[model samples]
Target: MTSAPVDQQDSLAAWLSIRTTVPWPRWSGERAAAGPPAADGVRDYFTATRGDRDPEGTARVLTALDRALADAQEGRQLNFALLTGWQRYVLHRDPVGFRTLPAFAKGGRERYGLAADTAARFEQCLSQSTQPDLPLPSRAARTYLDVLFFHPFEDGNARAAMLALAFVLACDGACLDQAHPLQVTRWADDADGAADLAVLIGILISATQRRQRHRSPA
Candidate 1:
């Protein structure tokens, strides 16, 4: 008799379990220096990654980014409705909704199983983007991973993740000048990788501020 295929473990659960335990790096409240507005790194990222093959799709993403940034600037809370609004543009669809079935990624190695409370849990996670205790980098990093592991939408989830990351930083008046470095495969269960991402975000924020300072006139 042949053996059956092994069931994939719930990557989402693994992520939620370790989310609060990750050793997020500390930040000293450093922010980007005052100067001429920097080029939109999130726009550049989408353009470079998808513009060649899908110009229309890239345009949609940029439009979504615009809306996300606007909401961030207005101090809007991050939630499913806000995300769905932007996601409609990213996906070029009128009626986008959450994924009802389990989602898989990384060549089917990781699965995000949906429970009745999954969406509620996701919203709770998003709300933490404004958590008072955690520093900006940690909050931003956590929000990014929340989107990644939640795998909320049926499609365009990666784009959604990037938008969420950008929005989280923008909420605090922080903008990264280089988002390319953040494009990497993130495993749901890797606690060290999660913390490393926070460190990387902190570095990018400081680097952007440094460049802005250099460009500013004395």
Candidate 2:
């Protein structure tokens, strides 16, 4: 019998050291940067709320991210997002009720969306949407933009957005987190005091170029 491929959680943990005890860098740490937006006004929040031996034995923050992405894809509206202080929780877009599904992630916060909820509807309607027009790198760029537009989660929107994009690139054997933690943190800190997808797109573009060169055929 053939073994099934590993799920997204394992892959993300493997690449990202999710829920690990590895020596994290002093800087570029979500632990150091949480609560109130940075002075620079990092738009979106990219926090990591690991507990200090707290209740939930092993927090599956990555899993939460996976669910949020899937939920957004499912065209389901969610008003009851889990916005916890632990585990990098911060809503991307806001007020995504079961009735509304707006696009434009951070800026697109609609208290009352059309009964038909177009954005989520469009996402659900898409087929092979994962495949991008540009090379894998550009495709990666688009995913960051699209999810940021969706803004599914109430917290950890950027991290979740980055993870979702990472999953797609990994499908093509390209990983973004290969960039240094400082690099990733730079992008996180660069959130436009609202988690600007455009800034993150720039970061992803640079990382993709590096990854392409690194993985280039010798």
lDDT of each: 0.89, 0.35
Candidate 2 residue lDDT tens string, 133-166: 3344444444553344344433454554455554
Poorly placed runs, candidate 1 (over 4 Å): 1-6
TM-score of candidate 2 against the unseen true structure: 0.38
Cα displacement (angstroms), candidate 2, residue 181, comes to: 8.2
lDDT of 1 by residue, 115-153 (tens): 999999999999899999999998989999999899999
- Pairs with steric clashes in candidate 1: none
The segments of candidate 2 whose C-alpha lies over 4 angstroms from its true place after superposition are 1-58, 63-115, 119-128, 153-156, 178-218
